[model samples]
Target: MGALLFRLQQEPAWFVPLAVLGALHVAAVAFRILSHLVLLLRRPTDLCHRYGTWAVVTGPTSGMGRSVALDLARRGLNLVLVGRDPAKLQDISDTISCTYAVQTKTVVVDLALIATPQGDEALRLLRHAVAGLDVGVLVNNAGLAKPCAVYLHEADVEAWVRMISVNLWALTEVTAVVLPGMVERGRGAIVNIGSGTTLTIPSFPLFSIYAASKRYVTQLSRSLHVEYRGKGIDVQCQVPLFVETNMTLGATASRKRRSFLSRLIMPTSDEYARAAVCWIGHGPLCMPNLGHRLEWCICHVVPDWMLDELCLRLNLWHRVRFQRLRTMRASRTNVVNDGCLPCKQV
Candidate 1:
């Protein structure tokens, strides 16, 4: 330390610029963190006033989508809930209508099949549903993931196709359906739910398709934000890490039981949704959960190779556990079948 200081004193001219550069970098980082804190501390914007009277949310029956839909309704915006199941959609719509003084409408569409004849008809229904209504917000929250992690070659082709259809095609088509009205009116907010896998790591091996599709979402959101900013449309992609939703419940269950970090990193769907609602129309890309944002900061410092290896191992661990559980369930079913009496004997 003394030798370094003596050398710096001897060459103060060269050292001063380096020192200044280091200080500036620190200041920039501090400013970014402080800005995020301010965003977290501030009040949520009034959706009904800032955007419009009606907000449309896809995949509104469960998980983050449901929570966001309810939060928007609580803020006095009428809701148009879109999901695959009519009963579940109606259940949530009824809840929103009963608890809040807001009107609710349910649109049943299986977004995964959006390319087929049935899907075209459903898309027509969706277009008809939002026509002439003042839709101020569009939440593209509907998405799909592989049931279990697997290598690219081992993955089922049909399952991957479905995931791509829902995560990419459906989101794009839905945005296309809603964005026209927002453009005509010159004011709107579009929120796309993105995964943290794409942002925090260089590569996600086993879940390649899912991560790749979300990367597309991030790019699409950013490009749209730039293209439509002049026209009064705010396009944002909210990147969340793991949340306790049905999609992740099985994958994360064993990990959470074994690792304290898993429990800490994964927030409940409602908890994440609450944070998500406050951040709409604020930025083009955001990590809504405070814990997730902290993790993201730490991830940036990690070398890409190290992050890539870590993600591979972690996903492999989940994949193995998932396979084991499936095998166990299958064995149990076989045992039950063997123990059952013959039909004629019964």
Candidate 2:
């Protein structure tokens, strides 16, 4: 024992560096765990009164956006529900008004039309809709992914254009419009819905552009949080893994068609929205769901190369499935068209 103690007292040069690194790793892990615990325990801020009575949510017609809009209304905040479809927006607004007894307004705008006269008109409409209200919370929840995973070279030009316009440009423009009011008021919260792709895979092989866009969101939110923290505006980038939304499930499929495995892994849109709202003041960034949090930890520990390979394989499988479905739909359409041609001539 004395001999071992004597040897330990004269530790090797390599051992010291390794020991220091291990200590740092331990400390970082502990700090993260404690911080998360505190966040879990903290009560959510009364968002309606904290900022104002009005909150604006983009993409509120369906999925995570719809869930978030409803949840905000439930918390006593009146809603400015923004979306592309006027009917859907009105429906959501009516539902919120009926269920939560909160005042609701609908702003119909296609945010994908960036930099065009149409886009400007849409922004004008949005501004006009919220002009009189004390807009407090701005949820930049509108985003688009490529229709399916594909190599950059294989991606359609128009699809890439729309993706960039909606995912990045729209977020930027909407924030610019809403932020000044928040700054002037000296209190607000902005939740930018980012994707797990930014946090998990070191490089998303198939969904490269989408991942990059989300990374932009994550970084922008963090920087803005730092810039505006003292001003009482909390900017959070909430990164979610698969939530059972049309974006995750194919657009043509009903939510009822989601598989058990998918339901197990992916939170329902409402579930994700509730957790995201609960973590509002707790972040520059966060993965709100427990399943997603576990996935984030696993991604950090896994070898990058291994993750790359796994993502590639999974994306390839999705591509194959997408192609097969498309082909089947095309075949059915051809059959129907052939049957209708004679009737049209008559």
Candidate 3:
């Protein structure tokens, strides 16, 4: 024991530096994990009172957007439900009003029409919709993705245009319109829905454009958070993995199909939205769900090369599956069409 103590006292000079580095690494990891826990466990702010009486949510007819809108209404805030389909928007508005007893308004416009005359009119209509309201929160939740992952060269130009229009342009424009009012009021929260593809996946090969758009959202939210924090505004980019919605499953998917997928790999949109809203004032960026948070930790520890390889293979498999499903659907459609056709005179 005396000899061991003596040897420790005479340890190599490199030992001190190595020990310090190891200590620092451990401390950093502990701090990170602790902070994440605090954020997750923290009680949510009284958003309806803190921000204002009303919240505006884009794409509120479906998916996460719809869930968030309903959550906000349930929390005693009036809602402006914006979406492309007038009928769907009205239906959701009515539901929220009936269920939550909160005031609800609907805005119908196609965000994918950006840069066109129609797009300009849509923005005009949007501006008019929120003109005199106390719009306290803005959920920049509208986004678009390819029908199926494909090489950039094989993707449709029109689809790419629409994706950019909805994901980037619409978000920017809507934020621009809403932010001024918030700045003047000196209080608000903005939740920008982002995708985990850009954050956790190291290389999103076939979905490059969609990933890039989400990266823009992540950067925009972080920058704006820093820029506006002093002015009583909270900006957060909520990165989500798969959520059970028409966006993840095809729009035509049956209710049972969505339920099964939700059980297997995706959280329901309502579950995700509830978790995301609780994290609004926690930080500039967050993975709100427990499963996604764990996945994020795993992704960070894995080497970049390994992540890249995994992404490539997973996306390639998705591509193959998508193609097979498309082929099968086309075959069934053709069979149905043939059966329906009037018999031609021989």
- TM-score for each of the candidates: 0.88, 0.88, 0.87
Instruction: List clashing residue pairs in candidate 1.
Output: none
Positional deviation of residue 85's Cα in model 2 after best superposition, in angstroms: 0.9
- Residue lDDT tens for model 1, 56-136: 999999989999998998899999999999899999999999999999888999999898999999899999999999999
Rank by TM-score (best first) = 1, 2, 3
Model 3 per-residue lDDT tens digits across residues 1-346: 9997688779998987888887986677677768767876777778878998889899988889989988888788998887899889988988887798789878788989867899889888888988888888999999988745799999989889899989999998889889988999999999999988788877788889999999999999999999999999999999998877864634435555555444434677898888877887778998888667666766877899998888888889889988987797777777677897443321
C-alpha RMSD of candidate 2: 4.1
Q: Give the best candidate by lDDT.
A: 1
Order by lDDT, highest first: 1, 2, 3
| Winning candidate number (TM-score) | 1
How many Å off is the CA of 343 in candidate 3? 18
Report the poorest 10 consecutive residues by lDDT, candidate 1.
337-346
